[model samples]
Target: MDAKLLEILVCPVCKGLLHLDKARQELICRGDRLAFAIKDGIPVMLESEARELPADEEVGQ
Candidate 1:
């Protein structure tokens, strides 16, 4: 992901800062416990498209 884009990206629901999980290729919103997928380098920011993070699931750095 582009640094500038990452800086501006946030959780759609909570407006919380997101962490790019490179390994998983997902934008992780810890505050909302959601993981937005990155498909073909574009983030799927739609709430319905986001996957809820399991209670014990850890968001990677």
Candidate 2:
């Protein structure tokens, strides 16, 4: 992901900061517990497209 794009990207649901998980290729919003998938170097920020994070799941850096 581009650093500039990542800086401007925010959680679509909560408008909070997103941490990039390169391994999973997802942008994680800890506050909302949503995982936005990154496809073809673009982030899919839609809430409906996001994966709901389990309570026990760790939001990794």
Report every candidate's CA lDDT: 0.93, 0.94
- For model 1, the stretches where C-alpha displacement exceeds 4 angstroms are none
TM-score of 2: 0.95
TM-score of 1: 0.94
Give the Å shift of residue 51 in candidate 2: 0.3
Model 1, 1-61: lDDT tens per residue? Answer: 9989999998999999999998889999988899999999999999999999998887676
Model 2, 9-38: lDDT tens digits are: 999888999999999999999999999999
Q: Model 1, residue 15: what's the lDDT? A: 95
At residue 11, what lDDT does model 2 achieve? Answer: 92
Top lDDT: which candidate number? 2
Model 2 misplaced stretches (Cα beyond 4 Å): none
Alpha carbon lDDT at 4, candidate 1: 96
Say which candidate scores most in TM-score: 2
- Candidate 1, residue 32: the lDDT equals 87
